[model samples]
Target: MSASSQSEPRLLFISGSSREKSFNKKLAKLGENIADANGIKGTFADLGDYPMPIYNGDIEVNDGPPDNARKLKALMEVHTGIFIASPEYNASFSPLLKNAIDWVSHIKDGGLQVYRTRVFALGAASPGGMGGLRGLAQLRLVLENGLNALVLPDQFVVPKAMEAFDDNGHLKNKENQETFKAVIQKLARAAHVLHG
Candidate 1:
């Protein structure tokens, strides 16, 4: 098939980091590079820009979703898949990402379940030995319940993430890069099959 005929699927990459120099952000950027190399269009969405107070149904009932929530919902609608690269805070996902998700879920004018039926892939990075695998596991369960998303079974865990990238923020670990690429490729392929 021609290159145009083989158009790649588009993914919305949600980076769960609020720090300017976050290792998880670097890992998500590396995943974007891998996605580009695999002929997938990846758009990175940083959680830092989308700030919201912790979810409170009573508060939401009084005040509506913020503008950032609307923007994220729009992006989610346009993309075929979502790839989340999260960081472990304590033993769970960063509060920033969790808040963004909460805000996105409150957009009632748009479909109640904006993420439902979408394909999702999960990954995490950390300085710890297990990376953020435990956090990603917990996140998977939450995402499944919230979105009813088609969660991919494969996941990428980048432990000692600071050491895996170079000064320019490119992933230097060949094995991890390969594994990351494979997971994203599988997500794109599955999205195509399920949504085509």
Candidate 2:
């Protein structure tokens, strides 16, 4: 898919893990490709590039938000749609992702509430049979209840994600690819309906 030339991107995708070969990141790449193919501008938000210390009230009070947190929060506000590809940690999503959410939520009152009206979608990729499906539920609760956001009911969970993608990170199975494309479409349409 070609690059989106829009001055401001309408949608953003992020993988919740920071691992080098994170399966969730591979899944998020599929969402990006699908969005661009469908003429939707998708921005891939890398948590690794936006590193900050774990949230501590003392630190936040002393130093204010870290530079990376501020940068990430800024990026988040520009998008009307959000799609998250998360990896399961224990029975929930990653602490890295949770912290990022906390940081961004703090910035909501600083400007237009980022999570209030935007549309959100979720997915997960795992090597296990459940494919991180359990974590997606918790993630959904945090987005909808904790942040007061709107989330789509349908979600994708790619089991055996270790074997799901090729070397170039594209889903090798034709059906899986199509489903991922559908997820992107749903997010884009929801964003248009809510934020257009």
Please list the residue runs of candidate 2 whose C-alpha ends up more than 4 Å from where it truly belongs after superposition.
Answer: 1-9
lDDT of 1: 0.79
Model 2, 1-196: lDDT tens digits are: 1112234338888999988889998888778878888899888887999998899988888888788887876777677788999999998999999998897777535523777767889999999999999999999999988888899998998999878888877888989788878878888887776677
Q: Which digits, one per residue and each the tens of the lDDT, describe model 1 over residues 37-64? A: 7778887888877777787887778877
For model 1, the stretches where C-alpha displacement exceeds 4 angstroms are 1-8
TM-score of each: 0.90, 0.92
All predictions: root-mean-square deviation over Cα? 3.6, 3.5
Output the TM-score of candidate 1: 0.90
Stretch of 10 with least lDDT, candidate 2: 1-10
- The residue-level lDDT of candidate 1 at 120 comes to 89
Q: Alpha carbon lDDT of residue 79, candidate 1?
A: 72
Q: What's the lDDT for all of these models?
A: 0.79, 0.83
